[model samples]
Target: MSTEKIKAELRTEFGKGAARRIRREHKIPAVVYGHGNEPIHLTLPGHDTMMAIKHGGANALLELDIDGDAQLALTKQVQVDPVRRVLEHVDFVAVKRGEKVTVDVPVVTVGDAAPETLVVTENATVQVEAEATHIPEQFEISVEGAEAGTQFLASQIELPSGTTLLTDAETLVVNVTAAPTAEALEAELEEAEAEAGIEKDEPEAASDEAAEDGDSE
Candidate 1:
């Protein structure tokens, strides 16, 4: 992926209080590490970083301009407040062009399977290694007009140039199955109600109880 240039400021203060102060200033505290170098503490523009991540995937190319020096990095991890939806901290990993990196790419299913057939995903993401600058955001699998009982495996997925699949070839990706009908839904509902100790509708329930009586008779 092409690097997105984002300016960041060096952070000297390090602590919970300092982090909170940085956030109050609408900045995101982050650290860049990798290549056997000491981690650098920095602050990024909160809104811009959030927007970049929203547009780019987690392995977003970050062209960081820190204190007049340019650095290429990728977002390694992001800590967010579960309730507030605010970014707490982020970790960036420095990378060099042409270097290979392993990261999980999301799986995106395209096209529709056969009518009355449902595409069930067994794996949501796959691990792969590729050039840092050419990492794929996701893998797209097409199941257009596939019949029921169709299954897709990881080895069957096509990888982008310079990308190699790190996941096992035997890993299941997607499977096609028959869609549940109204009668199937009713049966499932009845089973769920029985499991939850809920009363079923009267006439149908009476028939089941009578079946027991007839068996005993």
Candidate 2:
């Protein structure tokens, strides 16, 4: 993966109030730590950082320009405000070109399965180790025309060049099964309703005596 260039302003203030102040100015407070180096607190442009992360996929590699000195960093964690939907803080790990980094790559399925087949993605993401510059954004598996009873395992996934799979090879990632029939669906619905103590629709109000007479007849 190619690194995105972003500017970082050295931060001297530390506290929730300082963080709020930084956000109020449309900036994000972040820290970079790794490789036995002291964590460096800095402020990043909110819009640029957000765009970089949005476009860079899960593991956004960034080339931070910290006061003219360039440092390669990998996005480790991001904290966002649940209600405001704004970035609160970010954490990055210092890395270098050619260095191997472990990251979880999202497993995506391209193409549709066979008609009347249900495709279940057991593993949404798989862990892998690859060079910092060549990290894959995601893994796309084709389920085109896959039939029922088909199972795809992690070992069967094709990894990119220079990437090493860290997840167990035997792990089941995708499973294809026959779609439930109408009768099966109705039975499940009835069972769920029974469990929930929901009463099914009944016949128009009929007296117990009349009902018993009708049954007898």
Query: Each prediction's TM-score against the native?
Result: 0.87, 0.91
The worst-scoring run of ten residues by lDDT in candidate 1 lies at: 52-61
How large is the C-alpha RMSD of every model relative to the true structure? 4.2, 2.6
Q: Whole-model lDDT, candidate 1? A: 0.90
Clashing residue pairs found in predicted model 1: 1-133
Q: Please, what is the whole-model Cα lDDT of each candidate in the order they appear?
A: 0.90, 0.93
Off by over 4 Å in 2: 197-217
lDDT of 1 by residue, 59-106 (tens): 887889988988988888989999999888989999888889999988
Model 2 poorest 10 in a row by lDDT: 200-209
* Model 1, residue 98: C-alpha shift (Å): 1.3
**Residues 1-217 of candidate 2: C-alpha lDDT, one tens digit per residue:** 6678999999999999999999999999999999998999999999999989888888999999999999998998999899988889999999988899999999989899999999999999999999998989899889999999999999999998999999999999999999999999999999999999999766556567678899999
Using lDDT as the measure, the top candidate is: 2
Superposition error at 14 for model 2 (Å): 1.3
